[model samples]
Target: MDQFRSFDQLRTNELSVLRHGFFKLWFELTDGQFCYGKLSYGNFWKTIYILEVEKKTWIIKRKGIFKRSFLINDLDGMNLGVVTPEIWSRKIRLSMNNGFEAVYLNKKLISRTFTLTNDQFGDILNIRTELWGFKKPFKISFDLDMLKKIPELPLLALLGVNLVLIKQAKAANAAS
Candidate 1:
């Protein structure tokens, strides 16, 4: 993967995701290209594998007796961060050793929390993240040629975070 441009450099306002269901999704770019991924669930573990080009790579996974959290790891298997769900609050929190922390909330009709960081490159819920959510659905399509150019980690972050969000939401809905 290429060195990521700062969060400020990417035109995040142009990013969009089309969730096919709870397990399948497509991340669409402003130029009409898409990165796709799938969520695999098991009794004691869950994993998300995203196809950056033609190869499916493990982005994040949750495994154990409780399965309360997910771990993000690099290609070398070094832990990059952790994403845990606040079951009672129905929130997904991503925390990294490097001081990045974010809280994701449920999607609303007009205010879908898609992506974007605050001025300090902080969490999406912070007051400084401009509108802090999507104004409308992104145009959905696929162009495989564009996938190689898309930075991988950012897309991983998008897929993993939203996967956690969707799981929490579904669990909350089921509880009710």
Candidate 2:
């Protein structure tokens, strides 16, 4: 699959993360669709398990507790590959099984990137991958006019962003 076209929908007018309770988060599309995830502890240490809103499918399994590393899978539970953070370079690199490398550029102001699937590209969230003042919640923006669609790519992209932010928070906490 072409890297560029695979994640063309990652950016749009409507994507937001809503907190239902502590550790219970839902990816809310302005069109009333929802994708949900829960933060858990176990063999994976800190694992993020995501469910697509439409089919209630577990599309993402992020298994890195002490670091921002993940092996993202597809619908059939096959490994798509991993996303590792290059903090020194301010980028998240997605390494796919087919030897496709896509970069998610992380900057203080704006960060943008894409994820890949087997046949086609998928969801994109228009978000800034940075945390603000202490104790402030993270924020994401979605194109409200885009309408509702499948939740696979959005969930993938969201999981990737969460991993990056969580790693940054951990580092900061460790430093202090």
Candidate 3:
């Protein structure tokens, strides 16, 4: 896959994260037609998920046995960033080695909508889950201007989706 220099190069501000398989939960990020990225579980326990965007691959895995944080690493095994969730709130913080930081949190306690915001860029992206779909795909809306400022916008967006999936899985397990 060829690398996209930025999200603006994709020529669209909207995308979707769709699940392909039944049991495996393979996911692909698309703009309704073309796939921009894909994600798959690295193990049966779902502790690790492999993320592929353009020509690059990343690994997102649980940080520790007793922690809720996740660590992101590149294909070369270099640590790229970390995703840490606030204990008493739904907000999650993404901190990268380059000093870029952002927050991903729900728009409302009972809503399926989520937003990603940066201190400098405000709200850069929004993700809403369809209420009627079996796949429950995430509809992503991006701020192109912010994309220009943050080169890692796509990676951050996908990571936010991954976090949401992790939370949903935990909730399902707890319910059953």
RMSD of each: 8.4, 8.0, 2.0
Q: Best TM-score goes to which candidate? A: 3
Instruction: Write model 1 residue lDDT over 91-141, tens digit each, in one string.
Output: 566676676566555445344343323234333321111233343233222
Candidate 3, 1-176: lDDT as tens digits: 56323345577888877888877778888876677887789998888889887767889988999988889999888999998999898899888999988889886779888899888888889988887766647888887776678878778878878887888878999999
Candidate 3's displacement at residue 69, Å, is: 1.1
What TM-score, computed on C-alpha atoms, does each candidate reach? Answer: 0.51, 0.53, 0.91
1 versus 3: better lDDT goes to = 3
Model 3 alpha-carbon drift over 4 Å, by segment = 2-8
- lDDT for 64 (candidate 3): 95
**Worst ten in a row by lDDT for model 3:** 1-10
Q: Return the TM-score for candidate 2, rounded to 2 decimals.
A: 0.53
Give lDDT: candidate 3, residue 166: 82
Off by over 4 Å in 1: 1-12, 18-30, 33-46, 51-58, 107-111, 114-157, 168-176
